[model samples]
Target: MVIEENECILLQHRTDEDNWCIPGGVMEIGETFEETVKRETFEETGLEVNGLELFGIYSGESCFVQ
Candidate 1:
């Protein structure tokens, strides 16, 4: 999500599910995770990002699977 200087995040409202979520999507073919992040961010929020770093990786049963 694109967080502004005020610490507000860019969230998408899902009409089908009636929920709000951070902008993200599945990784495309031959695309790296960082590339997917950049593309999804732009596609959803119309913003470009740089200087990405490792934050955390979630797995296990509780995590969503594509």
Candidate 2:
């Protein structure tokens, strides 16, 4: 999830589910990890990304969230 310049987290309203969620989707073929995030973010929020930094990577997670 990304925090916008206005201090608001970029969230998309899914029409099917009507739930708030950060811009995210499955990565496409031959795309780098950073490219995936950037692509997904823009696709969902219509925001052009300048850069992104990875804080951590979780593997084999058993629901780190909820």
Candidate 3:
């Protein structure tokens, strides 16, 4: 879910966690799954309601988030 804006890809810098993810995080309890994707993108990269286009959905048990 990387947002290609200008020249740089939108990445998150979490002070308490990983510093570079494509603006996403864990789902809050009872919240919609898409809510996690949308909300996390905003909270991390500070972009909201722009031109978000879905490229793909990723799933795995390994790698960075694992």
Candidate 4:
């Protein structure tokens, strides 16, 4: 998820892949969704965020592969 403020958003650039994308990663065992978001955002962007709300949850056949 990208944090938006004043119509601007935060993104991370992947030097290995040479692409820009939202900062995120797989959730660790025993970590809540919010905790995962905060940890990934900090790891990728060096920024700390708080007061997060659940945005949306996506899951379906189209989101995965057989």
Candidate 5:
């Protein structure tokens, strides 16, 4: 999910690790990609979001999996 305001983007500061990244998480069972985005964004940032659009898709071994 991309949250842009005034040309700035939203990023999450991770508490468990020393890094800043875009807010996201693993998809729950039976959840679509968009649902996962909405759920994770709210879980991480307390924001309720809609009007989702595809930003990109990544695959292959270099992608993170959990």
Candidate 6:
């Protein structure tokens, strides 16, 4: 997440779920992780992001989160 100097984080509101959340989406074919992050972030928030640190990777059939 992008944290400003004031320590406020950037989050997106999900209209369908009626809640606030960290913006993310499924990766596209042939896209690098960085490319996916940049594309998804801009698509969700209309903000461009550069220099992302590798965070946790999670996967499993039961890994669903809301």
Q: Highest TM-score, which number?
A: 4
Write the residue-wise lDDT of candidate 6 on 1-66 in tens digits. Answer: 452437778888999999998888877789988898899989999998886887766567676645
| lDDT assessment of candidate 3 | 0.67
- lDDT (Cα atoms) of all candidates against the true structure: 0.75, 0.73, 0.67, 0.85, 0.86, 0.79
**Poorest lDDT segment (10 consecutive residues) of candidate 1:** 1-10
On TM-score, the stronger of 3 and 4 is 4
Q: Residue 50's C-alpha lDDT in candidate 6? A: 81
Runs in model 5 with CA error above 4 Å? none
Q: What TM-score against the true fold does each predicted structure earn? A: 0.66, 0.70, 0.54, 0.82, 0.81, 0.79
Tens-digit lDDT track of model 1 for 1-66: 444457776788877889998877766789987898899988877888887765655556776567
List model 2 lDDT by residue over 1-66, tens digit each: 564766766678998898987777766779987888888888887887865877654445663433
The per-candidate count of clashes, in order, stands at: 0, 0, 0, 0, 0, 0
Pairs clashing in candidate 3? Answer: none
In the predicted model 6, the residue pairs found to clash are: none
In model 3, which regions exceed 4 Å deviation?
A: 28-34, 60-66
- Candidates in descending TM-score order: 4, 5, 6, 2, 1, 3
**Cα shift from native, residue 62, model 5 (Å):** 4.0
Please provide, for model 4 over 1-66, each residue's C-alpha lDDT reduced to its tens digit, 9 standing for 90 to 100: 779889998988899999999887777779989998999999989999997878886657765634
